[model samples]
Target: MISTRLQDAINEQINKEFFSAYLYLSMGQYFESKFLRGIAHWFYVQYKEELKHAEKFISFLNEKGGRVILNGIPAPKVEWNGALDAFNEAYNHEKFITSSIEDIMKIAVEENDFSTQNLLNWFLDEQVEEEAQTLEIVKKLELVGEHGQALYMLDRELAQRQG
Candidate 1:
């Protein structure tokens, strides 16, 4: 059985994951509005991935016999200055999520919750990939700054991303 504190933390993380999905979806819409279809598709994929992350947490919590009480997700920012801005925001959010997972890992350690700690390790590794990918995109966008052809090529490359 999960401790009450750990359970509450897991519930909070689940809600955050949902919010991440919402934020990515909103960004996807923003890209669509800009007519960057490939970028939009990428964000759509990210949005779906975030939902899967939430479901994974939910399943873990259920397996631990913990009650999950979902909280409301706040509105995500829909307007970005450009692709660079969107990717920067995403990279920042990934950093925030990494910190959150670390906080939960600390709690799990404190509570001697080995199972929860094990599960969080997966998230920790995921965040590393998440942050790396976003940052890499940010760098590429930076290089393509104010270059229309380059941006177009990058968009085409991004569109080829599968899953």
Candidate 2:
């Protein structure tokens, strides 16, 4: 069985993951409004991935004999200065998520909860990929600044992303 502290932490993470999904979906809508279909598609995929992450946490908590308690998700920002600004926010959000996962891992270690530690190990690796992917987009957007053609090309490349 999971400890109350760990259960609470996982529940909080599930909410954050859901918020991440909402944020990405909002970003996708922003891109769609800007007529950047490819970029919007990319954010759509991110939204799906975040939803899956939340589900994964829910399943894990259930498997550990813990109750799942969901909370309300706050509204995400609906506007950005540009693609670069949006991607920068995404990168920063990923960093924040990475830190959150690390905090859970630390708790698991302190409590000698091997199962939770093992689960968090996967999240730690996933967070690395998440941060790296967003940071790469931020860098690419930086390079394409004020270059409509370059931004369009990058959008095309990003649209090719699957799942």
Candidate 3:
């Protein structure tokens, strides 16, 4: 049986994952409004991936015989200065998520929940990739600043991203 504390923490994480999906979906719409279809597509993929993350947590909770209590997701920002601004937010959010997972990992360790620790280890590695990917885009956007042609090429490159 899952401890109440760990169950509560996982429930909170599930809400956060859902919020992330909503945030990315909002960003996708923002990019679409700016006519940056490729960038929008990238955010759309991010949205889907976040939904999957939430579902993964839900599955884990079920497997552990824990109750899944969902909370409301606050609305995400609908505007950004540009792709760079959006990606910077993304990078920061990933950092926040990493911290959250670490907190949960700490609780798991305290409780001696080896299975939860193993699950969180996967998320920890995934967070590294998530942060790296967003940071890379931020750097590329920095280089492509105010350069329409360069941004266009980058958009084309991003369009090739599959899911």
> Clashing pairs in model 2?
none
Range of the 10 consecutive residues with the lowest summed lDDT in candidate 1: 142-151
Clash count list over all predictions: 0, 0, 0
Model 2, span 83-114: residue lDDT tens: 89999999999999989889998899999999
After superposition of all CA atoms, the RMSD between model 3 and the true structure is 0.8
Q: What is the C-alpha RMSD of each candidate to the true structure, in Å?
A: 0.8, 0.8, 0.8
TM-score of each: 0.97, 0.98, 0.98
Model 2 reaches what TM-score against the true structure? 0.98
**lDDT by residue for model 1 (43-159), tens:** 999999999999999999999999989999999998999899999999999999999999999999999899999999999999999999999999988876835898888788889
lDDT of 1 at 58: 97
Give the residue spans of candidate 3 off by over 4 A: none
Q: Compared to the true structure, candidate 3 yields what TM-score?
A: 0.98
- Cα displacement (angstroms), candidate 1, residue 33, comes to 1.0
